[model samples]
Target: MNATTVSRLTSFAPAAISVLAIEGPRTLEFISKCWQPNQGSSVLPTNRIRFGFTKATDNQPRFGCNESIVVCRTNHERVELHCHGGKQASEKILETLSSLGAMVIPWNQEPCLLARDPIEQEAMEDLVHANSIRSTAILLDQMRGALSRELKRIEQLNANGKLQEAVDCILQLRQRFAIGKHLIHPWSVVLAGPPNVGKSSLLNRMLGYDRAIVHEQAGTTRDSLMERTSFDGWPIDLTDGAGVRLASEASDPIEIAGIDLTLQKAREADCVLLMVDPFSGWTNSHDRIYQETQGKRILVRSKADLQKATSVPPSLLFDAQVETSVMTGEGILELQSAIVAALVPEAPDSGIAIPFRTRHIELLNRLIGL
Candidate 1:
């Protein structure tokens, strides 16, 4: 008989639990050879779970966990093995099973057995690897045919020759694609400014902990520090770049490398938090740094607690700017809201149809043409 193919169906990172699926014509045979039931005979019911230990090729306990795992033969061709969710633990279990002749692959490399339709399939596929809860919810919404229902109505409108209404609907839906695409990937938000301007302070305040170092010294940070955190339930990668300094002000070679990374992060960032020490107000240096961010920037005035109105220039203005005082914890919430607004200002109404994958977007674009 052919070997059963095994694939991990859960995240590889350490978690509370991990699941692996084995499917093939010989899945039952493979399980019969390796699975040792705790209290009953080796015969497994089609739909019931049997608490057991998997044996190595030499017939020794493979998992040998403090608590044994439960195995289920879901059907004639499929079996599922669930175990503790550590990288090494799960990998060891998989390795043990593989030694007895099971082909191993990632979850996406294997087709989902229970997906009911195309929408469900896509949602299931995306949901499995989704890095954030928001992405999971969005995928679940799509699985309920959220996008399908909207497309159906659009198709009907096209059939009725109501071209104007259809065009308007398509335009509205098209606007949501960018937001949807970022649901899984996360938008990169870079904190950039001159040294001691409180870029790191803002980052720390927003994250509710001191992830970045805050000091009075210039060029204190010479490396980019990044963290992935959720804002208003949406995922975002917060990048704290090294402070931007004038060519003569660059402290050393390390600072130069850090400055290079700062510029690179600002250029690549989906949203740039361009900070200025309001105590000193807006200056020519701030303006020069602002120019480097181009269109993808949000101006922020830091140290509002030590505000000096005269230090601020009258002509200082930005399309997106907020006053923040990390010491007093003011405007931090507003800053978060502004970041979300800058990244994905408009989320679809709850339960509304929205494309969750590139394939769905492509099809919607085709319909827009029609």
Candidate 2:
């Protein structure tokens, strides 16, 4: 008898539902041992989802329990169990399956056993971690053979002695990698500026809810607060760093540490919003912070409602600048647009082949010599 294998297919975090996959020559027999269909025989037909309750075998009466579940038979050898999300219901089902001679394996391993190619395997693995609707669609396309088809076309081009065409195709695909890489791992944008510059307010405003503490005090935020947010379906991490103050001005050790961390994160961030309250105007400390995030920084004029209209400082507006007022709800949309433009100037059109994994990039690099 072939060994039956079972694995949980979704994240363990509590949700409305969870899925488990069972596959092997004896999968149906093993499932029938524990599954008690609500309205029909325990024997499940192929390709039909049946409602049921799972229970431990009579021999193992000590662990007896019933969990409401729905099972889908993909084939004679494969079935899926959908149950309430969390550890309890799924754990009971797994325990019952294990008792019935099914081998439990890691969820990641299931893809390797079923996928036709490495690309499909990677796509299947990453699709589970996609955070946004757009990301899910892109990964679904890849899993459905978008990248595989493109690679086959490239191979055909190279074999036909069209070397230049193949090279150009690879170059074009590489360009999309910038966006592809961020599909699973979001781009990081840091909010860095001097104390009392409205960094916290801007963070709360952009997130559409209050995440960081907003106070009038200079050092209200002494630590970093990171939140995941999306703009136009692009995933991004916005980190609100502590209010950077001059070392001499900051007397407390904890405040000094926070300032140091802000500068460090600013240096490492993909983009930094260096803010300046127009009421206080730009100072020497602002210039120093700007130097830390020189290339990947945007100049933001905050508290715009409190100040009279004035031209943006030409020297400070290196990347781009937006005037914002949290109280009046002004310039927030424009700021989001600026950020999207800075990070992703152009999103990939639908159905485009995007190299998303390290292995895909390495293979493309090797093909350049061909």
Candidate 3:
């Protein structure tokens, strides 16, 4: 209760403003020494942002720069300093706290308990660095005790010997956690195929904009391009990788390198969209590249408007297949839905309770075993 811990809680990526968290029972005392509130009193009220300026540990204005800072007091034990995100402002804040004997650390190095309970702290920690709005919403729900409340209920159910209900709860948590685990890191989906099969076009169509360059030139894409977007409230990292082709057809060493990199991306991607020109029918390269992708794959007949074949042959052995046209926008929404379903088979509703960390689930599983 007496030990004060200070940490820079916001991202350090050269933003317009930054935030620093000062926590512990002695937080107000240390803050009073360095931060002078505009009202001329250093005592902060709970849940209110007090305007302030940075001062030295000896209670003197460090400089005449007259910095405008908004300080939020969550409680007597917790204070958040919102200041200009520039390097100089952050340095002054950290220097002042360190000079006062307060433990200054990075956000990640802050102590585990951020709030009164574990889930609230975990969600707050994530919210500070959330990249997308969808991720922020999901974490905000967790902060409302959605996951913690659910876990406690399951624990009681298990203790009451309701084995079936407990099992169902555990299974649900485990399933939903897959999506929760990717709050920061988007789920990766790779667009892969032979050159000029409309992989780039499909990517553009999905994004509803010209994010990927579309052209008739083979091997136009010499490297992977990534785009970030949310599908059905789930964040996705759509990667447009270079098209894989046979050595005879793709002899350019640069394109060959790109193709090799594409293969590796497909192997690691959460879902692979194997696009083929339906007019061209099934090619040997199609099967060869399919074999290279290790996990979930969707065979897509691209340029569906130019179909010249009777139908997709069963011998092609596609696990799942869809026809899409970038020009006419045929099957684009359906393909997007298919991709979402493939990556997250079961979609979680907003505010659904799902563990965001491995330890949270592990502890629940341990309880089930007990």
TM per candidate: 0.83, 0.92, 0.83
- For each candidate, C-alpha RMSD in Å? 3.5, 2.2, 3.3
- The digit string of per-residue lDDT tens for model 1 on 154-266 reads 99999999978988887877788777787778889999888888989888899889998888877778899999888888888899978887777775888889988988888
lDDT of 2 by residue, 36-82 (tens): 78886777889888998876686556444677889999877899999
**TM-score of model number 2:** 0.92
The regions of model 3 sitting more than 4 angstroms off are 13-17, 25-29, 37-49, 55-64, 108-115, 128-134, 208-211, 247-252, 307-310, 315-320
Task: Write candidate 3's Cα lDDT for 308-346 as tens digits.
Answer: 552544664554678888889888888888887887787
lDDT of 3 at 294: 74
By descending TM-score, how would the candidates be arranged? 2, 3, 1
**Every candidate's lDDT:** 0.78, 0.84, 0.80
Residue 124, candidate 3: how far off, in angstroms? 3.2
Off by over 4 Å in 2: 55-59, 111-113, 309-313
